[model samples]
Target: MLTRTFLHFPQVGERRERALWRFGFCDWHAIVRSVAPSPWRHLWDEWQREAEASLEAYEVGNAAYFAMRLPKSAWWRAIPDFVHRAVFLDVETDGTHRITVLGIADSEGYRAFVRGQDNFDEARERLESAKMLVTYGGSHFDLPVLRANFPDWQLPPLHLDLCPLLRRLGLRGGLKAVERQVGLSRSPQTDGLNGWDAVHLWWRYVDGGDERALQTLLCYNREDVMPLPTLLALAYERLWAQTLKASQQTFLPMMGSKERRTG
Candidate 1:
């Protein structure tokens, strides 16, 4: 999807991109090798340079380039390509919204950073090294709380916020609700737990010294991060179909997904 995208080209919005697709410039390489007459022909030379640079960036797994070029709503295009460098994240806050627990997971495993107990060096390293960040409401809630908590931490450049993305797919409401709507089931322990419950659980451990509460809270946070990969994969499959259909292009196995069929 990254190689197939034209969004990185300057002044090339979705309309122009679709126009290119209609003209059979299906990917960056096609544009680089084309001499087709079109409205943007004069810009092709410049676009070709940019496309080459973009392709190099993609090949080297430099996700920040696309993150800066592509619009936030279209960050899904970078997901399939950079998912190995991606991390799923969620933050828990106290009553006043002070971040208490920070949870992150990558291909390796999940780790939680508690406010006073855990040093943030590892979390900071993980986030800074990550190419993409997946979160439910990180844009409005988790991220803001994180910034307040760690004012100087460098975050991942590309963020795929599932709240608005899922909303675009007509799956409305919180993460758990959207999860169930998409046929994802939570574990029995964390099934119905919500943000308020997370806060209360933190207090239960913090104020009452309840070890079970802390363990349960950790489980809940892990559960929040666990389903993110599947959700993004599902969203990518649906959005890719929508993009191809909207551009009126023949299916071309863009991501090497066996599920995509020629039409």
Candidate 2:
């Protein structure tokens, strides 16, 4: 999708990029390698330099460049081919202001980050280094809560908040509801848990020292994050199928269930 994107450069609006496309200047590499024609030749050298710099920035894992280059709508397509640098995020909080637990998954696997029981620094490190973030409702819930929790923390450059995207496909309501529509059924142990149940689990753990409650809470939290990548991938395919150009559209495999669960 990044290769198909022509939005990174200055002086190249949709109309101008269409001109380039007609002249066979289809992609960044094509533009850089071809000799520019008369009218645009004077600016070509500078554009080439910026293009190389942008590609280099991506190669070096410099996500800030992308933050500046891409519009939010294009973020989904711009996700890199390799997803190891991406993280799936979800949080379970007390009904009020406290975050009871968070589950984050990356290429390595998913784990629950429980308050007091674990260090946040490790989760913070993975979140900071991730290039993309996949979440069900992180934009409205998790992200704002996290920002309030840690004012200085920075999220990854690209975020695909699936709640709205799925809504685009007429899949409405909550995460569990969306999962059912998409055939991502939860396991029996965690199937019926909700945010309120999560709060109960936390209170039982903290007030009564019920270890079972904590484990169940973690299971619930883990379940919240585990299906994000697949859901996000499906959202991408369903929503983009109508809009993506023929040259840009291709079947992208969902991340392996093994990597998603274990990683």
Top candidate by TM-score: 1
Supply the TM-score for candidate 2.
0.82
lDDT of 2 by residue, 168-256 (tens): 77999899999999888988888988989999989999999999999888888888998888887787676556443522434322333
lDDT value, candidate 2, whole model? 0.75
The residue ranges of model 1 lying beyond 4 angstroms of the native Cα positions read 251-263
What TM-score does each of the candidates earn? Answer: 0.92, 0.82
Model 2, 46: alpha-carbon shift in Å? Answer: 5.9
Q: Write the per-residue lDDT of candidate 1 for residues 60-152, one digit (tens) a residue.
A: 777778888888878898776777788899998887769888999997789999888999899999998888889998899988888888889
